[model samples]
Target chain A: MRHHNIRKHLSAYAHQECSKDEHNIIENHIKTCIKCALTVNEYQQVANFSKQIPERSIPSEFIDQLKRDTLKNIEISKQKHYPPFRRLAFAGIFLLLIGTVTLHIVNPKTPVEYISSSDTLKLDEMEHLASILCNKENLIAIIDQPIPIHSLIVTLKQMKKLNQRHGQVNNMFERIMHQINGNVLQEFPTPLSSCKIGGKFDESGLTQMITCLRSYQRYNDTITFRYIASYYQKIRS
Target chain B: MELHQVIQKYQRPMVAIACRMLGNLEEAKDAVQEAFIRFWKSDTQIKGDPFSLLCRILINHCIDKLRKQTFRRFFSITEIKDLDIMKSNENPHKSLENKQLVDHVEKLTTRLKPVQKAVFILRDMQGYSIQEISDLTGFPENNIRVNLHLARKNMRKWLQPILKED
Candidate 1:
């Protein structure tokens, strides 16, 4: 073999990775070639130095720690695979329960006092009645109560006639009439106008007024009537 | 074989290879542990020798760590010290000499490219055959031989002055 070819195989030859024939050829060649022999010696020393670096023993504590950590990791992965629907179901039920509790706290079911128009209307109770008209819970509570339909209609008519006399109460009457269904005023005879002329309604006329007022027994009509009645009573006092 | 059994059997050799590749015992242990974790998490069926598969995982992990080390070194001045493999109480003079030689070898190995460093350490220091290195690294036998040759040449050139002084 040529010198370059022999030198190229020196690493594999030193490592005993070359074929037997190639090893023998290099072995014989190096015997006479001092440069090749010195190169082989350097290769041997390199290999020896590499092997002398020493193998460390694995620490027992490290193995035990690894085992503990691996087991812990596997357990965590198992928890991650837990059924998603079960978590969703839990969240849904929790939200439903919170909604129910909030509803109860916000709008409690309380006894609603029945205030007829014939009841002694005090000025102090006007504020309380106004609050009842404004509060949703109170409005919903009074929804089932008997509404003084005829009395409310008469009071609204008297207030409307007074509104024409006093320009200041015109806005308040207009607002109250708007809330009480202004069309109802066109349907009913202006009873207060007849009262100003000293003329009384016939029995049939009273029946017509009662029938017209009964149609106004809806919740919104009741709230509007309560508000107007209280304000009219306040103005009269 | 069971994973625990594999650990018991191959962890020593794995740590040995990793220590030489990384030059740090703590990092070697960490790399070996990470390899076991990866092997455990992998869904692929073990179709070949378990030891070879484990060594491949470990070597790849060590190479990634070496890259990260280089990246960190770009922004910092800290150096990784070579692990002292010999106990000082055995023979202080011989232990010191061996330590110096091991340090020199580690420093020279670090200068090599990752693939060349792996091939050289497995072939020379760990005493694996070229075919075994090929099988473990998934490289062809010829590729492994070329890398091994280049690595040895570099080591020889760097160690010439040191060896001559000794």
Candidate 2:
């Protein structure tokens, strides 16, 4: 091999990292090549000097501090994973309450009752009816009524439109109509009961019912003529 | 092995490797401590040698620190400080000479890329075999060899004038 080729391996050569055949070639080359030999010597010297770099003995205090810090970190991590008894108890109770509320909303205990045609409701009774339908205390009862799945879906869509309109239009005409005729009408149109649409009371239907009631309560501040008009519009449509 | 025992047994050597890689004892200690904490947090029932695993963790941590230091150095105006050369009471003259040699080595090694510095330190300073370095660093033996060769070549170039002056 040329001197240049042999010179490239000099670092590995100093460390004896070369193959036996390569080592023999380099050794023979170095015997005749003074420059290559000098380069090899320099490489060896660098390796030797690096080896002589003293290892620092860790301070005893540093070890103690590291142990304390590491153990403290481990303890903190352990606490993170396994919470304390009272905190765990609080979490458990909080979860139980949430689960109970969810279960009550999902599957109410109040049975479905059919409203008779003679049980006419006055317009002034809308507020009382809304309170019964949308009140948190009566939420389970409202969800328990056997609402037709199709009607609930339709009502949910209408209620969403009403909510969007209520946000956009805050005119005096609508507000005045709401205040004057809000409680004076003579009949509460039971659109839910009037619809005998055949459908199963499934999860989707219950969800729609809950959503409609939620929207009704949400827009309670403006539960005026427009809302009743929207109901009538739903009936006519 | 238990964690405390592992810390007690391997702390010195691991810190030595980190010191060489980082060129600072305090940073080395921090890196070694971080490695130990990571080992504890990780699944300890590791498949292979625990020491090698710990070495791998420490080395990677040091490399990450070096990268961040390089980045900070790039944007910041601060100058790099010289390493704290260890002093010896037995023979102050010999200690000063050794200190100069160490300072020169530290300066030369810092010029190398992180991986090259790591390979050079592991092979030349710490006396690890190429294969062991491969296992510890997860780099192929050929890659380690190339890095070692480049690192040594750089060191030789830098050390030639110093050696001649001596």
Candidate 3:
């Protein structure tokens, strides 16, 4: 009958669940009693073996299916609540406001300062030379001086037209556009030192730009010649 | 993304436990698949240690299966058939050690009520806490303690004889 209390305390001892006073009582009883000690030892062994029971691997496929199904349900729920027309209306209103504000600052009508400058002949020759060079082999190549700015602008316009017509521009047209957008092409004539070497257009400079673009082809297929023309010498609005 | 993967992950342990408890492959597989279906349908709340939750689901499912009229009759016939097959076997020595362990556990388990058998298995074999057993079985903590005590006492009576013999 006395063993009942001791036996009751054994599981608590095995699980470390006894209060300090109960724990000391159990410990004292265990030392004196072989039966309770054996019981505690057996319970501990069982507990240890139970812990070793191998954990089963949950199938990865099951988890993945659950995730997919949950996401699908979420998407379906979202669609029911948030319709396309409402989303489109919010986006359209946002874009319209942005467009109005941008137009106020970047007024497209402002003429470029370079157009009113004194060197009209150089500019005209540049334009003429640009047009003549349009059919030139390796169109990415630099033109030696005496080329008119009008010819250059016309050539750019023609390339733009060809790209628009065919819906694509080849690598050569792409390289030329890169050069025009590059720092070398953007530099003004007064500090022409950086833009000039040996008082002629840098042919090697043009070749290097084309080679650099070979790496870009993998990422960009459209071959965009578009640039922020507002920052450069003017094109009529 | 696939129910197949979830089944694969839980299958080994689930199969082992189900086979051990139900003592047949077909029933074990059915129980496991049904458990999976239940898991799929739940919006929430099968709380606490995933393994314990799964074990509860599987054990309860097997118990429910055993309760059915058809399964109860079939299981009794199968148990008799199994005993007959074992007796017919010539090589008794091969099963001796395993038989000793199984006999001891079975003797201990037969004395327990169904709930006691489950709580005992969860506590002794599965190493669940009193709280975990309560959570799994929806028994109160005191009821789990009483059941577990009765289970251990039954087992202890057998163990006393075995230890004395040793």
Candidate 4:
């Protein structure tokens, strides 16, 4: 090694990490080089002195106590972080409460007369269906009652017309009505999908209804009346 | 047995190592305590020596703390004054002069860079081999030796005045 490298490795030389050849070179270089010799000697002296400096004395009793305290603290910290279980339980309780409320609203005591293939849904039936939805707090037309094609047809027309007039005011209910209408069409196919109210009973029809409703919320009443009047007229024809 | 039991076993050595690095018993204890808490909370699969893993974690924790302190010290001149260069307790086993010497030595160590200080504590004080330090620090063997050499040189300069008086 060069003198510079020899100086750097002197601590190692003092600690005896050198091979014979490397040791001989550093040893010879240090002997002639006074600066290297003094520096190496100083490094050796410090290394020896450091060995004598008392190891950081940690009292065993203190450390044992520390371990116990840390163990206790760790448990506390874990509890602090582990709040999800409680939150999940709260969520479960909330869902159960909603399910109960939903069961009460969608009860079977008020039996709905489903329209069969030979029968036509009368104007009273349409009025009853509209009143059931329009009177409720959350006015979406999913009543959980057994529904025939004619009543559903009337329900779709009323919802579409209501969406046109008042949907902007009650945006959430309008969206729900839209989703339920789509689901009924996709999941339950019917031959008489369109109603006498001149509504297409599809997503586009709902959008037009919402646009018309957006013009004036009161326009919904006129749309609803015409919707029922046209359905009866078409069925009579 | 468990992580807590493992802490109970090796905590003294870990504390000693931290005390040397941080130069304060309370901070050292905090550092060691945090290391165990973190290890217990960790998802790491310990496939090797648990003792060695814990030691590495403790050292890294101390080094990180020191690095932050160093950064803060750079912006504020008074910050360095807060370093509590520790002193030995009044033990019947240790003489006053011995405590003075150890205390003086610790005071000298406060001037060292964090890496050099860690290397010195591990190699000289803890009697760890050069290879072990390299493995623990993930520094090259040569790098550990270089820091060890610098640490010794720095301590010697501090000791020179005392040594001459003696």
List per-model TM-scores for chain B.
0.77, 0.78, 0.61, 0.76
Ranking by DockQ: 2, 4, 1, 3
Name the better of 3 and 4 by lDDT.
4
Model 1 agreement with the true structure over B94-127: per-residue lDDT tens digits = 4457678665766678877788989988988888
lDDT of 2 by residue, B1-166 (tens): 6777788778778888998888777888788888988888776696655888899899999888887775545422221222222221343334457667765676668777788989988988888999999889888999998889999988887555455434
Query: Where's the lowest-lDDT run of ten residues in candidate 3 chain B?
Result: B157-166
Cα lDDT of model 3 by residue, B100-157, tens digit: 5454444344344567667776777666778877876677989888877776665555
Candidate 1 chain B TM? 0.77
Better of 1 and 4 by DockQ: 4
Q: Largest DockQ belongs to which candidate? A: 2
Candidates' TM-scores? 0.53, 0.59, 0.40, 0.55
Better of 2 and 4 by DockQ: 2
**To one decimal, what is the Cα RMSD in angstroms of model 4 from the true structure?**
13.3
Which residue pairs come into collision in candidate 4?
A163-A210, A164-A209, A164-A210, A164-A213, A165-A213
Model 4 CA lDDT for position A92? 96
lDDT of 3 by residue, A1-237 (tens): 267778886865776866798888888888889988888886664444334444334465644554455445545554666566998998999999999989977874323321222323233443443443343332324322222333334344444444455544334444433445453344523222222112122323333323323333334322222222112212211
Show where candidate 3 strays beyond 4 Å: A1-3, A14-20, A34-237, B1-5, B41-55, B66-111
Interface RMSD, Å, model 2: 1.7
Error of 2 at A103 (Å): 20
lDDT of every predicted structure (CA atoms): 0.65, 0.65, 0.53, 0.63
